[model samples]
Target: MNRSTNFVLAQILFVILLLTACSTEKTASDSEPKKKEPKKETVEKAPTEPEEMVKQGAGEHYEKVKDLEGDDLDKEIKELTKDFPKDMKSEDAYNRIIAAFAADHQLAFQELEDFDITFEEVEAYEKYSEEDGEEKKEGPLNVVILLDASGSMAGKVSGTDKMTAAKEALKKFAGGLPKDANVLLRVYGHKGSNDDKDKKLSCESTEVMYPLGAYDAGAFQQSLSKFKPTGWTPLAASIEAAEKDLQGKEGNNVVYIVSDGIETCDGNPIEAAKKLHKSNIQAKVNIIGFDVDNEGQQQLKAVAEAGGGEFQSVSSQKELFDEVESNWSKAMHDARINWSLSMDSSSVNWSSSGKGHSMRKVYSKMLDSISDEFELLRSVKMELYNQKKMTNEELDKLDKLIFSRYEKLREYSTNKHDAKQAALDKETDRVLKLIDENAENARVE
Candidate 1:
């Protein structure tokens, strides 16, 4: 009844108390009667069409039909899509339908670059590429200005003498050429009077007053001052002289002739121009017929054609000055471009027009592709229905779906084109403005 009895009773009481607490915890308590319920887990519903699938588009459609056209296209398509899913369930199945018939929903910008078999090479070959010459290896540039110091050049035009006008233009041109370009000032027929007796001396007189070297303002001015118009024109002989000046020189070579008459020294100017513009010389001979008559214009124009150059006839001093300025600026542009490409591509090797045209071609192809896709889808759908592979309801649903995707693709392609076109136009304008600024800066007079 002492220690043992007391220990056993205490243990029994403790066990009873623990059991009572556990029982109370199982149900609502007096202090906090409300019992908390367990939270139910949520299950999210997936989207009908996945975004990644939409982005992927029915892009494979182009791959299948890209190599086919006309009846052959229809035949190949029918054969390929013979097993097209009749019961469209998964996103993949819908995408397959697009692949079989509809155009791709994703129109990439890379399609605009280079002449690939995927794109029609019409514009690539016909319009833009010809403007781009072959990549040429260059060493230096030679620009020769042929001044016709003939008696006819002493004549007046627009209140200014032809000779004086020619001198000012030549001075500005020679002084403004690119630093790397070598300029030769050639004066023809400056030795004799416009007399029949002095024809031999005048005809034979063609001198390179400012020898081939970098533009020298003072030296060029001195060269200009040393000559005066006093004899008959020696146009052909002058071309030959310029050819001699560029004999061993390399790179882009050019000759500009300021004349008022055709070759009167009995030399063939056209043949001379042909010789100068040969592949070996690679020289372009431009002729400016100042106050020339009809016969002189015809002859000079022919010479320019043979020389792979341009010809213009100016009856006024302003026209003459402008022609010279333009020719000089153009020549300098070519020299500066050493961009190693055609002058159209700009001096930095970016072809603004070319890129624009290519992009436009891409845009056009996109629209045509969309149209072609719609037609193919229509044909494929009708064939499926006729073969009992699909029902009317399925055809209608798929047609609507294909049309919707086509609309989105067209919108996407258009937006992309607009954005790229804006950038191309901006770049084009910038390059042209840069060229113009360069030209203005190069003008010394």
Candidate 2:
């Protein structure tokens, strides 16, 4: 052990001791509790698009005729007589002819909801002359004329401006209407408020330029001239409004909708129509699509179905005029639509198809029963409301009864029985007859 070696060893020992002390301090610090980190939260996202719905439809039918004399005949005739106008055109005559045919054949006509048409305009004009002043076989009608007024229609109609053209056609049609008939004029997408430029886009929205009534053709046309095409099309709102206008009015209410485009606003025209049908609004909707796209055609067709009427697609002004003329003709001649289902070349025979005759009859009966129940409930409610002396308690009771009945009705409808709604079916036929009779009697003078 020399003195130099011992000094080196001593230096090495001091270095080791210092390192051990630092390690001890680090271990002690690590033993203390530390703050925990938060877990990242996740949020769910909603679907960015709506599911697509199928656009399929099944055809419908009507028994156009009935000669069941006495009360039965009266009941059947009454069912067929509602919602008809006093004056109709040749085009409106088809419904009547079909009813007569149905009666003769003892069979019903199968029809698509959108295929209602008038056969021909009756030209005699003097058939409705008062003979001995006997209550001239009464024919009364209420018609709604919907005219298109989008910017596209700004030009002349049949050599006149679009608005003018409509007025002219309407005037001509009215010339053939009975003096006692009612007429309502509706113009859509016609004008825009000066204050807003955006509103101009939807200028073709609907407006009731005239309520249902007998009036001068010249005056009517002049009145219609005030409207100009400068906005967007609000077809749905227009239809809904028209339905509201005809809400509780008497006689047959016909909605003759004329348009160039589909609905462009926040409205469901088809749904509105269905509302009209389900509620038995006493209004039948007939649609004329004037130069539209496929989508527009579909929407219009749906609207017609909801209205329990038909849709007519027009490609040109001439076609539009022709359709109007034909409708007038049908109204006068009283043509009936004896709808029959010829076996579609691509499908099986109608009789042998999935639904048999007995099943159909059963379904029809069920529907009739349901309709009766609803009518009873509705009458009860209306009566209660009419009683001005009804107390709050009574009102509450009525409301409960209505709700309960409706709930039951919904349940039954969901059960899938192909029931015939008697009131609805009867009302549909009545409307057609009244319109035809009116057409036969309508006079320009």
Candidate whose lDDT is highest: 1
Candidate 1 on 249-351: residue-level lDDT in tens?
A: 7547888888998888899999999988985778888888999998989999999989988777888878777767654465455444244233233433334
TM-score of each: 0.49, 0.43
C-alpha lDDT (0 to 100) for residue 293 of candidate 2: 76
Please give the TM-score that candidate 1 achieves against the real structure.
0.49
* lDDT, model 1, position 178: 72
* Clashing pairs counted in every model: 0, 76
Q: Deviation in angstroms for 112 in model 2? A: 12
Q: Candidate 2, overall lDDT?
A: 0.52
